[model samples]
Target chain A: MKITNVKSYLVEDIVKPFTWQVDRPGSGDGRDPRKNFSCVMVLDTDEGISGYAKGPKGRIMMDLVERRFSSDLIGMNPLNSEKIWEKCWDTDRLEEYPLYAMAMVDIAVWDIKGKKAGLPVYKLLGGYRDEIPAYASTTSYDTLEEYRDVVEASLSAGYPSIKLHLRYRDVKTNAKLCEKVREWVGDDFSLTLDASGLWNYTDSLWFGRVLEELKFEWYEEPMREFELESYKKLCDKLDIPILAAECSDGSHWNAAEFIRRDACDIMRTSTHYKGGFTGGMKVGHVAEAFGMKAEVHGGGHNNLHLCLALPNNTYYEDLVIDVEDIEAKGQGQLKFENGMYSFKEQVAGVGIEYDHDELETISIQKYEKF
Target chain B: MKITNVKSYLVEDIVKPFTWQVDRPGSGDGRDPRKNFSCVMVLDTDEGISGYAKGPKGRIMMDLVERRFSSDLIGMNPLNSEKIWEKCWDTDRLEEYPLYAMAMVDIAVWDIKGKKAGLPVYKLLGGYRDEIPAYASTTSYDTLEEYRDVVEASLSAGYPSIKLHLRYRDVKTNAKLCEKVREWVGDDFSLTLDASGLWNYTDSLWFGRVLEELKFEWYEEPMREFELESYKKLCDKLDIPILAAECSDGSHWNAAEFIRRDACDIMRTSTHYKGGFTGGMKVGHVAEAFGMKAEVHGGGHNNLHLCLALPNNTYYEDLVIDVEDIEAKGQGQLKFENGMYSFKEQVAGVGIEYDHDELETISIQKYEKF
Candidate 1:
């Protein structure tokens, strides 16, 4: 069916704020918590079906959609996702359309396609599995003790593995913490590290050596994504799989470079950052072709769909900040039980739930284009 | 239909040999002409339909199919091209299956798929056009006068554009020749240069500046394909489109790296070097996504199908070693008339004509696996 209208809602304070512990001394007391706002987009079609997705949480994302994409999206068939994706990328050389904006449109269009086909998004993408093991991915915390407690709590809450996002600048302390946590979690537990693209070559080497000794599952983004040469060196010097290209610009295109250079062992992909399912799957297939894995970067219904569909992807990431907050919110349709995340059976589309009343009350701005 | 058997034939002296002019001192009189042998691959299915494709011209390609790939092909469905392609790449990390070997299987599979569907391969690939403009691509020649004669002959033979494969090591002489040819052809005719990945960085820059001044359509592989950083610098320095990654490994993956780094303005792709139709299409889509052209690298029925199917690819290449030779062996099925290559209407599969009696006469080795 043809898309009749495109709508975006800028909602405030819908998600709980989450903070990251600071590593650099003068970079403020701690990293600011994520803004508890979201840009929710909806595409209304002539068949009376609406597709929904969450875009990057801000006015900028909404403004980009309204000014640059909404008009172009009108009168297009939602089922022609590839054509629409190409249309959006037609101006990429100059516009450099942010991944999130493209992701929002593509994800919404796939949602419409799935609903029409009477299948979930993952099935439409060629499903690999209904359940996937999940890792507890954490925001950086202040102390070693805090890390230990979160690791214990994550295990108790049914997570099979955990990935530590440690203080950016303090390599030594992070290494020590990794060693201590490995001891606490014991030998069989799957533990990995995400340095958040913060280390220099020498520092990354030093830190990577420690991870190797500790038998960490993977060493992630120790250097900035653009430092491909450095990443190549790291891959050569260290045995640990280097997971990279999480926030890099060119999506599958950039990920292909990392693979070609032997720079990254695991590729980071998400509907939120990699132009939704279409771009994410391309990266996944490219990695798979090279005998590498493309890991889902975040925890959400969209990412859950991807984790299920991608054969090369091993684990779904369940973001854990405060244990209490995670317990209260509860993971949506993707239920975590027995240390695995499983999709609810027979659900069509992306299977994301929307609270219309909450969305209406929290929306600060609404834009509709026909 | 289930693939029942895979067969390979090594046939000798099936093609006319053509020489390449040498550029470096003591590199021998001229580069040895291409071997006159060819490896023909056929996939026999249970449904009594057989698919055909020409592999890289040698016994090694036949050996690769027999020793590594034939067993895997026995029970596969020929229509499941993507699955078979992925199965081949399953060992890419260690085995590093050469592009031509993979291309042979993929192209043969597509042939079976198209014949089964009663359509041309281009139509199965989502047909973009029935015809594409053709460029006469010349082999390197010793003298400037010989190059001038070939360019004149190509124009008379219904070619609108011509790409010069020039003496690689002599940049100054090549530059002078480019200027002379441009002046002879006038400003409107499309003239481009291919250096065959021979120049060093400094020489590449100097030659590129001359090409830019002469307004060549593109400067191709001025430096080695592995020297990506040098290509990136050349792209930044030259305003003319840089066509690259023609002989590079990794197919769409490597092509993606060039696009991501802005190393080339146009990408070089062909079924013979990329992984056949599937791989060529992926590279085409990747370039299209970035608003770049993916030029077909060589001439043949396979490359012709790609030129018609890919929206961003502009011209089909018609390799012209000598005017007399090309005139005697006219392009097959893909007719070149009035400056364009057009496919025959209602032809199924790749529409390649094979002389079975000649193949039998020239066959030196035959292999079959069931």
Candidate 2:
């Protein structure tokens, strides 16, 4: 199939609120409204099928690809998504770069291609499964009440487990939150503590000790993502497994070195940011070879498509998008039943259905590629 | 100081085509056009001031930043350019991020800010230089004829000295390029060589022996930018100093650490891809603090803003953008004279004026900022 149009919609309503340790938090040094937003790209094919890619940071990346690399895909056989991804990536074309945007778009396009071909996204990725387990990850919170509500909400919403966003607050608040949540959920449920790099070794250690007393599943990002030596040291100091790195740059070398050095126990396998499904798949292969936990980092629908089809990844991060919050539509949004989610067996893309109204609301703009 | 608008222009033309070895020259990858192109970004402020930024893989990085960050700067205070850069970077709201795009935008904004404030960009960074010196970096072929022509061009153009881009050719080529040019200039001329990660341990040792014959100033990037131990070994084995970096990620700590450990002689600086100006300034500061050569890498009108302002950066690279390549207004463009160039005195904002036609050609169709 030949690709026809690559269009971007800037959703006015779906905003992802900022929760960065984004400049030491509350410093007034941070302000990005886009932090609370989503930008979607729809790539239409001449065969009457379309691909939808949800770029983490909006219209720019997808929009640019539409303008620049459009010709690379347009009129070319659309089934060769992986080959096309490689072409876009290998085209360094700059003295230095952000090749990742091209990557995210490529995968999204692949998802669409798979659907059009009447196959699953992961099947094209060498399908390792028909479904995968999931963990509901709370996006953000400001108080204990917020944490409790999210925790209790995730449980009732049928997540096999729950992950917390811990940062910028007092150590006592974290210690207390973990202890209280564990008491509320009991030892039978899986509980994970994600600090998201807001802590130093001392902070991670303090929380690690308390989480141990409460028997938390793992401590995510005890230190910064690349603090390999510290991560290794902390792994030795605490009995709990440390899961990290959704934002580490460098290469698989960064992750490989961490594992080779015994720095982490549970590994976060990410597409787009790290490497796309191909990169993430390779990371999964490495983690499994090393016997590390491989979980999908949050907010990647393209990844969840592959995750559901992979076995090495038993835990998928469920970014409970308030779907109703925005008019986003797709035919492949995965379904959750009794804390378990699976592909719909349509073999047509990810199977998340699309909403036409949501699609109509986003701003459509053209970027110059030639 | 209010940035009423953030106008971004994608510059696809190469002032001078750059050549570098990729896929080892004879590899089948040579047929790839993606490997052959270069892109640059010019950020113009609403107040008739402009800052030029070279992106990470120029076009891609430029697109990513312009897509996500441009809208933010539309009504922002240009005075807080650095602060804005940190926000986009720290939060990382976008996907495929090393987020170098944000950094590129940040740098150009600062240059624009400096020009608007009637100071050199580096002066806004604290008046580190009243005037700076430069090195003539020739990108001509290694063949004797081309080398002779370019060196003569550089000399007639009146640079205090020159640096050779060495690789795939030989010591003989460098000798021919430098010694002949030196002899032609009659002895007082200085020279350096960029091995461009071409020489290894033994190769460096061999080059060291041969280099003394010509009395080259320092060998640049004699090995890979990160090969600290090898560099240390090479440095110990040679009498001549070694210059390293320029082609690097901002977080090449191992390289900096190696320099900290006395691995090489100079710290080569580049503002294009890493963190744009802010990141370059950080690296420059690190080099200054460590008493290493803050040799400015890459050449351009934008670079002129950097080179003329940093005292610690005694030498600027010659990445030329001919007057014909520049579409900006006025006689503010640079011209080589007496082996030196002067920063315009008391001129406000990045000094270069934009061509209204070029501006209209790349103007935004629409923009809104919070």
Candidate 3:
């Protein structure tokens, strides 16, 4: 079916106000927390089926889709997602499109295909499983006590594993925090650390040693993603798996380099940052070919679909900003139970239904193109 | 239809033997000329329609397809070229597949889809033009006089452009040869040079300045493909368009980096090196988006198809090893006439038919996997 229209709505205050770790003090690149705005995109086809997806919180994504991508997308076959994706990605040579913008379009196109085929997107992607265990991926907390409380609460909430997005404190302070967490959670629990690409080679080496001693599952992006040589050195020196290239550009192509260089033991992929399902699957399959795990980086319906579809992916990252915000507003239709995430079996498209009426009420701005 | 079988035949002495430029003296990193053999690949479907393509002149590609890729490909829908391309590329994470092996399978798959749809492969790729002007891309000769003779012969054969692949002599010698050729062809003859990546940054700069003064069309691969910083500097220092990354890995993703960094003025793409048709299209579209020409490298039916399909590509490279060997065996059914390359209209699949009888007679090795 030909896509006839593209629409986006900017809904303000849709998500709860939460502090992202990158915005906290001592974080090397301090940035403000994401605003509570959510951008929802919809693709309308001539055949009466419509596709839906959520974008990052801003008008920029909406504006980009409407102004840059929408014209080329109009009158194109929705089932030709591969061609459409190439078209969008082609814009990168000049526009250098933010991964999120392309992701939104790609996810929506997959949604359209799923709806047309009358199957969930995961099934269309060659489904691997219906359910997947999740890890409680935390944001930075202000104090050691606060971290402890969140970890305890996540365990109480039935998460089987936890990944700390610790504040960029001194290595010693972070090591102490890790020690206390291990002491609190015991040795058998699955634990990992994401330093958010905040450490240099030496600091990463030292912190990695601490993680290895603590028996942490994987060390996530301790050094910057561009530091391939440092990563190679780190992987060689430490037994701990280095999970890297989370926010890196070039998708599976770049991940292949990391794999070829033996730079990272685990490859990071998600619909949000990895050019949507097509790109995520490419990375996941590449990692699988290398006998490595490709972890889903964030919690969302799209990421859940990816987790269910990718045979090599380990866990669905249930990003926890606040203990109280665990079952937060933007969780969509995905079902989370006993540390596992599942979705409706035969629900077509992305399986997330939006209340258009509610969105109309909350939308701060709207754009339409044909 | 499902691909029920994959078959490869290594036919010995299938083409005329000619001296390859890379094998000649003074050519840096000298290698032997390709043995006069051709690898013919066929993908048989349950529906009784088969797809055909040619690979490099070796059993390695045949072995790769039969041993590693065939089993995974057997049950797959031949029409799902995108997914299949991903599967083949995924193997590269571990196997590090030569681009030709993957290109063979991809080309065959596209052939199947085109045959099924009753169109040429170029039409399947959204045909841009039925014909593209050809440039006689020469192999390196021993002397400047030989180069002049080949250039004159190519012009006499109706070629509008000539790209000189000169031996790696000193800069002064090469500059004098380029000047002599430019003087002979005059200002408007569309002359270019391919250094085959033998120079360092300083020499590239010097030669590039001479080329700019001579009003050459483009300077190709003056420095190695991996030297992105040097390419950036060269592009900044010279007026001549630099066509880099002809043999680089990572396909369009790496090409995108070169474009983003302004490392090259022209991009290079061909089905033989750039993944396959899907990849060639990606790089071509990327170059088009950036308002740059993506010159199609090498010659053959598949590259001709790419030159036809890609809107941004300037010319089909009719690689001339020996003038008498131009229409020799293995040229397939593509028609070259009066400085242009054209394929049969509405000829289903890749539009090139292979004679199975001739192949069986010359067969040195054969493989089949189902």
What tens digits encode model 3's per-residue C-alpha lDDT throughout B172-235?
Answer: 9889889999988888999999987667899999999899999998999986565566788899
Candidate 3 C-alpha lDDT tens digits along A1-370:
7999988898654344454443232211112223344578888999988888887534446656655567768899989988988777655432334566789989999999998998999999969999999988887876888898888888888889999987754899899999999998999999999987667899999999999999999999986565566788899999999999887666787787688768899999999878999988988999999999999889778998999999999899987877686655235567778788898456898987777787787888888884
Cα lDDT tens digits, model 1, A1-370, are 8999988888754344554535221111111233444578888999988888886434545755665568768999999999888667543322334577788889999999998988999999969998999888887777878777788888888788899987547787787788899999999989999887676789999999999999999998886565676788899988889999887656777777678778888999888777899989998998999999999898788898999999999999987877775564344556778778877567778877567677677789888885
Sort every candidate by TM-score, greatest first: 2, 3, 1
Which is better, 2 or 3, measured by TM-score? Answer: 2
**Candidate with maximal TM-score:** 2
Off by over 4 Å in 1: A1-370, B21-34, B329-331, B353-361
In angstroms, how far off is B221's CA in candidate 1?
Answer: 0.6
Alpha carbon lDDT of each predicted model: 0.78, 0.60, 0.78
- lDDT string for model 2 (B1-370, tens) is 5665454445443233435443222211222333322333455556766575544333344444445565555667667766776556544433334435655666667767766666666667656655555666755453556666666666656667778765354555555566666576565578877776665577777877666677878888766543455677777878888877555443334335546547777777656544556666766777777777667777655566567655667776764322232222124456544666556454565555556576456543322232
Q: What does candidate 2 score on TM?
A: 0.73
- Candidate number with the higher lDDT (1 or 2): 1
lDDT of 1 at A43: 89
C-alpha lDDT (0 to 100) for residue A17 of candidate 2: 47
What's the C-alpha lDDT at position B150 in model 2? 63
